[model samples]
Target: MVFVTAGALDGPLLTATLRLRADHAPPGTRSRVFAVGAGLEITAATSGTALAGAAAGLPAPVLLLAVAASHAVAGLLHPVLRGTARSPAALSEATSASRRVQ
Candidate 1:
């Protein structure tokens, strides 16, 4: 049930965020945007798990509400940050280029 809800919410949010990031971020910054987004995702997942674990003593309803609230916050924030789209050639060039370093 949790996976189902998470997938339903996260799938579209991830798609839109990636599309916007590709559309709004500057050429020189796209890689950095991707890197930062990836890092945040990892951190969020880790933090959420730890928080949930630490809250294990709470009632199931309260824990669920907390999880939902966190997801809501993430959903609300996603659209406020946007990125620029790379042109086909630029994307191709980026793909052929060596990985970008932070």
Candidate 2:
């Protein structure tokens, strides 16, 4: 399973993502430290998206702002969707029990 969020604006942008896998691990290792972290940041007079965002196919500046405002409102509702999501809680117990029998 995975989760992701991203936001962009005039000054800066923020993004985050996470993924969990239910794969096998070495014997006796109750838990594993998979790729625990990642990050990136860049600054310059211009950024790649700047040109693409201004190109013909893209929406005009005003339209873009309106779209952003709409998403800003929808973003507030994001938690409602994720609140019902589940993680691998009971599966860990089942994994350990099955390992014991093996």
Best by the lDDT measure: 1
Instruction: Tell me the spans in candidate 1 whose CA falls farther than 4 Å from its real position.
Output: 61-102
TM-score of 1: 0.56
Q: Could you give candidate 2's per-residue lDDT for residues 1-102 as a string of tens digits?
A: 123323234224322222232233323442443322221223222554575566547557866886698799889878987686544554567766898999
Tell me model 1's lDDT, rounded to 2 decimals: 0.80
Task: Write down the RMSD of candidate 2 (Cα, Å).
Answer: 10.6
lDDT (tens digit, per residue) of candidate 1 on 1-102 = 999998899989999989977875667779998999889989989998898788989999997888799899988877665245456677756755745542
Go through the candidates in order and give each one's C-alpha lDDT. 0.80, 0.50
- Residue 1, model 1: Cα distance from true site in angstroms: 3.9
